[model samples]
Target: MDIKFESKEAERQYLKERLAAGFRIFAKYGFDEGPAGHISLRDPINPDAFWVVNPFGLHFALIKASDLILVDESGKVLEGGANRHLNLAAFMIHSAIHTARPDVNCAAHAHSLYGRTFCTLGKSLDITTQDSCAFYNDHVLYENFRGVVLDEEEGIAITQALGDKKAALLQNHGLLTTGGTVEETVFWFLSLDRCCHSQLLADAAAAGTGGATKKIGDKEAMDTWKVVGSRKGGHFAGRALFDLIEVETKGDYKN
Candidate 1:
């Protein structure tokens, strides 16, 4: 278990494979609303100014390791087939975050059903459920939704709004989650969207005059977060999902 990678090439292979797997995972969960979402990974060989992203307009379910396009901080496509092009929002927002936060190597953003609904509230998630504890005091709300994030300035604003959090709820936009690894980022995106769905249902149930929701105490929530929200926890949570997806696709995503 202590073995991380045999070499830099091995590390690169794993990261790219997981990056592709994250896309398929998102697609299976209904996170792909056309070309509205993206997952980026810091090129293991070039962690500073380069990253890998899926080609624009490609369906999440069909992406593979070889299909990812490498781009520089300035958004120029450096690799991927001749058909490769950049996703401007993916490049703008992700490049800013990758630059600002060297600690984060992976970021996943999507316009999932609940994320769209919950972000409209313009507030961070409330630690009312055990599962929501993972994000207790650990995520931010970027309430400044100035249309689509298609420019570097907008990306910078969103990054500033994110500050040092691992995830963000972009108001009127959607949810964005980042982590040190692909597994962690994908897991947070999955957990966050589900949490948003839970909140929506809970809100409907408590909409009456006297139906109030119970929230977890600060100490309790923080304690639970230590177990469920850690980087290692998220990675472990992804193992089952990844294993299943690989089997379902017959290891096609690893290509």
Candidate 2:
């Protein structure tokens, strides 16, 4: 299939809206902490580039649709429309994923509380509930904590760790999720965070007992996926996230 590039004006507008939608979703779910997480969309024209990412120091709740800073796959800032510096880790992580996975059009990374907790344990979430079933057959665990990823090679390693999985837990760090659309990618991130949160709550309720370790039957997991994943091929969940964000944030994701 041939990929088409949007007009410069259209690309900028589409990216602005999609990015704002992502930031709003993150904020609505309390996934961001003082600009600690990032999301990016692949440029419609450039296979080797993506739109401007959430810049360094911009709080998720306060990010505007027009504040995005365009960056290349090589981590160079092509346009800082908002006069902000790009987050190094955003470039490192997102650029690597976009380069390695041409099929993924959007990527999200965050250090949400529960996601970090699960990642620190280096364990994949079992298909223990409907919420966790989304990743029942696909997910990865990258346990090598190589400090902060300050270079492109580390980013490449992170992408390699992700492999074909839609989600990956960055050990000692947090979580990363990708998708064919910005909406899908944001939905996956939200699901991962919620799943981690649900698991944590279950563990707390179990009082550290084995109740937390109980796994959903494989058949049931498959059934749950059929219900959730097959719902317009996840377009429902993705759009729902977008709508929820708009409602929660008073229709103002762009500040």
Candidate 3:
């Protein structure tokens, strides 16, 4: 179950700690490719106006709650990072996502190894397993790569492609996942990469067998999705991941 905060201050602190913990968890999974990945959370007090992100070029493994910076939609640093530089791509992409989807409060994107490899296929994940069913009809493919995402136009285009989906595969790029909470977003991203890894392995084995991969029927996938794909189901799974990370890191992610 989700914890309830007595005040906005307490809620803000929780968000920061979870956001930083997310980075640490990603680092443990070898998801950090220099500064190529970013995960952000909308500030509890300023949900539409401001969000928290890591300083540009900082290693995700070394991220701490004190290292997060608050930025507005215009990319202005509001607090906590006067000396640190904001990742402009974060501003362009997250700002657009936060604006486009009021329900999404946290977003995670990374150039994870398997995610990029699977993105080359330019298709959604095949739901042949119970875990993959969580994203059965809840993901999309962003076919337009358009080089690096530096401009506002590119960010908006990506968000438009995302629509109401929980995850997206950026062709020739990587994976992007969004959720109402940091835990859910991180869980989806991690799970997405694992699914991609499984698919890649299956494809390789199938190539040798001269057979094609079998897909689960849509009706069954949809039925399983209702149980595992809902926000509540995601939160239930994400809570376990957050707990494991906290134990592994000795709770040092908290400031």
Candidate 4:
């Protein structure tokens, strides 16, 4: 499972492939809500800029490595043709995080059904299951919800709320996750969305039973997180998903 690159070009190609795989995988899991979701990977050669899918009418499932567009921190398209345009919200949210956190090479956000539903509750996930334990103390809940985030100031506020956390559940919005690699970031996004779904189900069942749900203690939850919440763990999960999607899609995303 070691990733050894002989050259920068090799690394860039790997990043691009993984990025495209991420989009396709997201689409597979119903993460694409129209053109609302975005995943951005920082360029290996240029840290100030990132590669993202172009804002065309293409669905995420149809996105390929060639469909990606390179954009600078100022939201200017640097590689894609004249027809390509960057999503303003995507640029605002992703650029703010990339600029504020150099260690974050990738950031992902989406209006996933479960994630969006959980955001409306205005509460962080409780440690109800081992999967939910991954975010026991590692996630935050952003309380601000001022409509669609079209302004840089709102983006900066979201960035501030996400400080030092692996995932943030934006109130009335959706989920955002960051990582040192695109693989890790994608895995976190998937994991957090599932956690939201699990929590909602648990809460509903508890209410039906007229009983309270039990949670893992902080010490135990933290220990569990050490195993499942690590970047290496996330990368492994991402690899598994990528392999599954590759077979299902016949590797079309690599085109």
In lDDT terms, which candidate is top? 4
Compose the digit string of candidate 3's lDDT tens values, residues 150-217. Answer: 99999999999999999999999999999988888999999999999999999899999999888899
Instruction: For residues 41-142, write the lDDT of model 4, one tens digit per residue.
Output: 999888899998875656999888888888898888888534587788888999999999988999999999999999999999888899887787788999
Clashes counted in candidate 4 amount to 0
TM-score, per-candidate, Cα-based? 0.95, 0.88, 0.96, 0.96
- Models sorted by lDDT, best on top: 4, 3, 1, 2
Candidate 1 Cα misplacement greater than 4 A, ranges: 1-4
C-alpha lDDT of all candidate models, in order: 0.87, 0.78, 0.87, 0.89
| Candidate 4 accuracy as TM-score | 0.96
Each model's backbone clash number:
0, 2, 0, 0
lDDT of 1 by residue, 1-255 (tens): 144898988987777888888899998999999988999988878776555556678899998998888888878787764567778888899999999999888988999999999999988898899999999988999888888888889999988888888899999999999998888888899999999999988888888655978899999999999999888898888778888898898889888
Per-prediction CA RMSD (Å): 1.5, 3.0, 1.3, 1.3
Work out candidate 3's RMSD over C-alphas. Answer: 1.3
Candidate 4 lDDT at 78 equals 84
